[model samples]
Target: MDITFLGTGAGRPVSGRNVTSSALRLPAARGTFWLFDCGEGTQHQLMKTSHKLSRLERIFITHLHGDHTFGLPGLLSSRAFSGGTTPVTVYGPKGIKQLIEMSLSLTQTNLEYELHIEEIEEEGIIFEDEQFTVTAAELEHRVPCFGYRIVEKPVSGKLNAIKLQGLGVKPGPVYGRLKQGLDAELPDGRMVYANEVKGPSIPGRVITILGDTSPCENTVLLGVGADLLVHEATFAADLPDKAVEFGHSTTIHAAEAAVRAGAKKLVITHFSSRYRQEDLEQLADEARVLFPETLAATDLLTVPIPRIVEPRE
Candidate 1:
């Protein structure tokens, strides 16, 4: 899985960045991209990337703020003409359904595909499939905002070709079973256990995306042990009071939350418009003092999620 920051600026568009929208590309795992927060001009941003609008399978809105969800109607409408025949599901808080329906209703928009809107009222497991499970939790925000935790399911290990060859297992359908960690019996009545020819299973990745919020216990709880924690840093660390007043987080708050949660990597976005690209980089540097693996996200920035491989001595 990978993340592409379409717009990293907070509140509104600025010189260097647009509003808040990010795309989680899972082409190999789920055969589609999941859009997290579709801010104004998000469809326009997608036009600039190589991603196809038709491949958007789900949209997870963090809040009802215009900066996070104003572009929903336009994008949903545009997808109908962009060869998107598959059904798309949107997951968000209580007002999300009303927002989408009202926008589409007011504009008299007709969609070719079915749009499923899941308005979450409480925090728990929101989405689960064979490949991944998505959980939601309440965050400390101005409104009833939420954060999403995506946990990918563990995958089978690679087949040991040398070990298989050593056991005289020819390349055939039996290899498929062995690769799936199943025992195979040879024609000579010799049974070969899958463990003999299969490496260790690959652990899945965990990604947490938090919306606009102040420092809270739920933030740390939801973000705990994530492979990547995408937290909001809307202000410098020195302006904690102002950040709290605005119901946003500072660089220090975000970094502290990541550290408390024991996240492996932290990528800070939702930057205030007052700061330029260089200033944002400095904020990232400040966060790095607390959480060394911190990154400041900019528009169109893609972060590939690293796999947690076991160390072999």
Candidate 2:
């Protein structure tokens, strides 16, 4: 999986950065990507990247703030215009459906695909499938907001081809059965067990993406043990008071959350407009004081989440 930051500025768009938007591109087998927080000019940002609206499978809105939602309507409409026919599911806080529907209605924009809007009624598991599970929790924002924890299901281990060959097991349909953790009988009546030839299963990655907010318990709860934690650092370390007043987080707060959550890496975005491009490294440096794996998100930056290789017995 890879996360691409489309916009990284907070509050409003600036010359160097746009507002808050990011895309999570899944593996090729999925053939789709999920979007997080569609800030203004998000569609334009998509145009600049390799991501396609037609392949956008899901959208998760953090809040109803303009900086997070203004581009939603336009992007939805453009998706249809660009020949998107697959269904799209949107998950967000209450009033998200109304906002999208009302905007599309007023603009008379017709969608070519089915749009499924799920307004979060509670904080828990909001989405689950065979491959992934998504949990939502409220955050301390000025308005109602949420953070999402996406956990990919564990992947099965690969079959040991060399072991099979060494055992004189010729490659055939029986190999498929063994790969599924089933016992397979060879033509000579020899039994082959999957566990005997397969390596240990790999643990799936955990990713947590948070909305704009002050550091709170839910932040750490949602980000616990995350392989990648995407948190907003809207202010410098010295602006703790300002951060608390505005219900936003500072560099220190983000790093602290990462440390408490035991996150493997922290990617900070949604920077205040006052910070110039050159100053972003300094802000990230502040967070790195506590969490050395901290990285400041830049527009169109892509970060890949690698799979963990388990040791064999």
Best candidate, TM-score: 2
Every model's TM-score: 0.95, 0.97
Per-residue lDDT of candidate 1, residues 175-275 (tens digit):
98888788989899999999877888888899999999999998899888999999999999889999999899999999999999999999999999889
lDDT of 1 at 276: 89
User: lDDT of model 1 at residue 145?
Assistant: 94
Prediction 1 TM-score vs. true? 0.95
Question: Worst ten-residue run, lDDT, model 2?
Answer: 304-313
Per-residue lDDT of model 2, residues 1-313, tens digit only: 9999999999999997999999999877998999999999999999999999999999999999999999999999999999899999999999999999999999999898999999999999999999999999999999999999999998888999999999898777888898788989888888888999988888999999999989899999999999999999999999999999999999999999999999999999999998999999999999999999999999999999987776765
TM-score (C-alpha, index-matched) for candidate 2 = 0.97
**Model 1: clashing residue pairs?**
none
